[model samples]
Target chain A: METQDLTIDDCWNRIGIWSRGTEKCPSLADVIHCRNCPVFAETGRRLLRTPPHEGYRREWTRILADEKETKPLNLTSVFVFRTGSEWLGLPAAMIREIVPMGPIHSLPNISSDSLRGLVNIHGRLHICVSIGSVLGIAKRTRNGEERDPAYSAPARLVVAVQENRPVAFPVTETRGIVHFTPEMVKELPVTVSGTKAAYTTGILQLGNLDIGLLKDKPLFKALTKDLK
Target chain B: MLLLLFEIGSDRYALDARQIVEVVPLVRLKLIPNTPDHIAGLMNYRGAAIPVIDLCRLLTAVPCENSFSTRIIIVKHQVENSGEVSLALMANNVTETVQTSLEALPPSGTIMAETLYGGVSGPDASELIQWFDVKKIIPEKDFLFPAGE
Candidate 1:
């Protein structure tokens, strides 16, 4: 039979790895992968742009028959922790790491309760600040063995970096990383006081509890200030 | 120098990769009647028709097997009277290229095919590769139908 008689415009299937019982195209080595080859890319474009056949409309109609599935992806990730009795949440991106609560070395002459002292964590000194005092949350200890069972996950210093300076704050208990959708976040209620509401972006609802989503910028600004 | 390597029958051969315009997959061509056995057909290369020479048919009587590795190596070489011509050299198992200068292949070797064959790489080399001069196999007078005519 004449070679012309067996002509095919799509040479890729005939020579490419896609073909059955055919050796892979020699050009594959130079191009490395099929995606890198112009011929392969051109073939894909031609496939999409080719004149529609009888089944073209039928194939597309069948594919488009079903409704698209929508999955509720958790868009916001935050580290939920408790400062005094108030549950606060910070965007996971802002908090660099969390370490076990250590002895805070009080800086001489600086007598602010908020700026507790410097804590040595992994040979690095981080300014340990009491988040409860910084936010002016009243010192009401949940005393006893049954003291906040859910939030009894020991205290840890949340290390966050601002302008290269690392600051560490104590959290009563960390809820680890929580993924929440937009629907779970509610606007700050009017009853939220000035000093407390100033740093919070929104209130995140988790089960029966409400978590104040702290605004990273304003909180960092407040922490860095009154240091000098 | 880089050389596009291919096997003709059992023996491996090479062509200067520098002369190679593009290594295209084997495609169907417009057949030309009364042409020499080595002359495969005219390939439509971007609207312009280019003549393709089947190196296997030229060397051996058998046509190249319809395998994926078998490809048309398009090259533009200087012709005698005509300045430059784009011709396709079809070969089998044209998988990869080798990086070695022609100087590496010593002149001392057996003469398989005189005019078309260039310097043969000595047995001392890792793999014996005979350099096929795409210039010599230009089908000067034998090519009855010149493409673009």
Candidate 2:
């Protein structure tokens, strides 16, 4: 029979036959036989029907939908904080409060990063641990570009209730709270560098930026040795 | 017998595989102060706090240079009523795992009760493998203290 006489069902059947046992279906080039067939046009239009959402919306939904399947609702409350130029997040439930930076009694004969002293919060002494030191990142110094007036950011404490007691972490700046579903989180590859991997639970791609989510329990446990 | 081979500086050392619980990546350690020079710090493994001893420092008094290859080998040993205690040994590098016969292993003399040195022969020649007695390195007293405490 002539190709023009072929029906839409015939075109689809031909394509299915060609696709059998192959990784890919027959391309448009192979479907040249159906070019003049009215049924072919109808079949193609039906197969490629656009949903209510088009272009970027369709693309984004497809990506997000796949992510949703893999990462169901693992609700994570993320508290955004700054460590130098990078923006990072820790679990908000893990965090107890955000306190004003105060005099941190430095313990002698310890690593510079290990701020082993206590800080008074609400008339109670809570151990103040420097997040910079715990993550092995350099302490933000006043010299160099940090001295610029535009670069000046107030330091804040991220008080977290760990092991049934309150522990405070010194952060450079607080960027507010974020809630993440499991689908929004991605693990850090073993090769990714910087302070992200050590304390970061995963990275949440929000808009144009990648926000790091901190693994609080593991990080806190690693930093505080004798925490009762 | 099975052996876990790890590198410290240029030298390769082996430990009885039976004592090892698992091998994990080098993690962020909490540095404890007023401790021996060889003790690097403490690492948290599965909710329990464990001390990490720098194997290079404990053996040669010089600290092991930290790099990507650095790893913490978690080892388990039964101690009296404490049942099983887990300790972490930080090695400069982990090369591979090997199995050999005890008959082929040479005796270690004068290395003390805590240290064992064995010889393994390959087709070419023999290499010295030092079996570390992890239990003796960190006494119970030092294990309880946190860094800078």
Give me the candidate number with maximum DockQ.
1
Query: On residues B1-149, what C-alpha lDDT tens digit does candidate 2 reach at each position?
Result: 88888877777777788889877655666788887887888676666567788888887777765443466787877666456667778886664677776644345444334234455543313566666555555566544443223
Name the best candidate (by lDDT): 1
Candidate 1, which segments miss by more than 4 Å at Cα?
A: A1-74, A140-154, B1-149
Q: Candidate 2 residues A1-228, lDDT tens each?
A: 132332345534555433443443345455455454445665654433222223443353244224233444567778888765556787777777888877777666566455557788888888877666666555456465554232245477778887786777677778788887888888887797766476787788877767777787777776676444
Clashes of 1: 0
**List of clashing residue pairs for candidate 2:** A96-A159, B32-B147, B32-B148, B33-B147, B33-B148
Tell me how candidate 1 scores on lDDT. Answer: 0.72
Q: List residue ranges in candidate 2 displaced over 4 A.
A: A1-73, A140-154, A193-195, A226-228, B1-149
Q: What is the lDDT of residue A59 in candidate 2?
A: 51
TM-score attained by model 1 = 0.42
**Least accurate 10 contiguous residues by lDDT in model 1 chain B:** B115-124
Fnat per model, in the order shown: 0.00, 0.00
Model 1, range A1-228, lDDT digits (tens) per residue? 233233335645666656665587888778766677777665554343233343543453343333434588668899889876788988887789999988889999986667878999999888887777667775435475555543344378899876677899988777888889989889988898787889888899898778989888788778767697
Q: Could you give the DockQ of candidate 2?
A: 0.01
